[model samples]
Target: MIPTNIVVHQHSKVLELSYDGGAIYKLPFELLRVLSPSAEVQGHGPGQETLQTGKRDVVISSLEPVGHYALKPTFSDGHDSGLYSWDFLYFVCENQEQLWKEHLDKLALAGLDRDAPMTTKGHSCGSH
Candidate 1:
């Protein structure tokens, strides 16, 4: 699955992925950060997802291609272990709204701020 075009908008902090069928997806850096496919975020098994917070202002520092099927994005926050496969990226694009809403819900449940550190003076996600 070759994306016809992949453009990273540094100014807008978004990644635009366009497929041959004319579907285009605009994904924000913060969204990508929170939904990273790395084990650090996804954990090794189900029910072990680590909630990602304090990424409201995160930006993509660079996007590196992995052979022929994935992208490795390095974020400004220093996270770079996730290898975004073509299928995974497409999935994110197709289910962006729902995924984003769920992320927000989880944050609310944990009382975490998207823009503030979890360990900030008064901010907490109720996670130890």
Candidate 2:
């Protein structure tokens, strides 16, 4: 289900998506940034994911439509690679709570904090 309306609430730091049947979702900027599907965040394969940190204050600087299938948002932190697909957005909206819990669990397991600064790490591929 594609969102009928998309609003970037700068003050609230959320991307509001309105769908049919009066369903609405407000995705936080931090959530979007941390869970970005881009390779930079997700990595090239399983177990290679890069955990995102220090994105609590991230903001969407611009939002662009990607051929009617997705949205490309340029974040204030200069991240613009993730292309959020319609289905992917819907899934995130529906599973927001669970996803957040899982993310927190991972952070705890890694002995990391969400507000901590992201450290520069070398990737196996030798590429950023």
Candidate 3:
């Protein structure tokens, strides 16, 4: 289900997707950044997922279409690896509430705060 229209609201920090049925979904920039499907965020496998912090003010610097199947967004933080497919975007639109809750839970469990800055001390690879 490809979106009929896609708009990036810089001031509000949301990516709005409108479908054929007039259903519109607004995904926050922070949500998109934290939930990015790239290896840097999702990691190579399941448990290796990295917890994204200090992304509350993250913004989409640019958006590029990917072969008519997905969108690649360059975030203000310089992250641009995630390719958001139509299906994945739809799923995200539908499950944003639950996803946000889960993210908050993870942050709490990790003794971290949503607005905290990302630390490089534990990331020995220096990939981030």
Candidate 4:
């Protein structure tokens, strides 16, 4: 297994997630929504992932720790389904540059930017 570590560097308007295994993911609330690991984003299975779009300035409103292995994140737009587990977090970190690049690629494919329009709907975007 690959090594991993997660650190939350909350910003004034953005929430930064750092990994010790190499890779720093600066996840804004909106980006987090689109990248949510829930069915909305992850979809039913492989090749069914719904690419997240139109999120640039998304900021995490809350970061609640579920025990010690996962996180229950609540975004400003009210989307949470991505229970960021330590293992998952480490995975993201280990592949930060690649994942972020893919994220940007998808954003570009959707004609979205880093500061897109904000939505009003809010819901659980994470797991227990």
Off by over 4 Å in 3: 121-128
| Model 3 TM-score relative to the real fold | 0.94
Off by over 4 Å in 4: 1-31, 110-128
Model 2: which residue pairs collide?
none
Clash count, one per candidate = 0, 0, 0, 14
lDDT of 3 by residue, 1-128 (tens): 89999999999999999999889999999999999998778877779889999999999999999998999999999999999999999999999999999999999999999999988646433565
**Runs in model 2 with CA error above 4 Å?**
124-128
lDDT of 2 by residue, 33-107 (tens): 999999889989999899998999999999999998999999999999999999999999999999999999999
Local error of candidate 4 at residue 104 (angstroms)? 2.1
lDDT of 1 at 41: 82
Select the stronger candidate by TM-score from 2 and 3.
2
Per-residue alpha-carbon lDDT of candidate 1 for residues 1-128, written as tens digits (9 for 90 to 100): 76889999988989999999798989999999999999778877797778888887888998999999999999998999999999999999989999999999998988877776744333233443
Which ranking of candidates, highest lDDT first?
2, 3, 1, 4
> 3 or 4: which has the higher lDDT?
3
Clashing pairs in 1: none
Span of ten consecutive residues with least summed lDDT in model 2: 119-128
Q: Each model's TM-score?
A: 0.88, 0.95, 0.94, 0.64
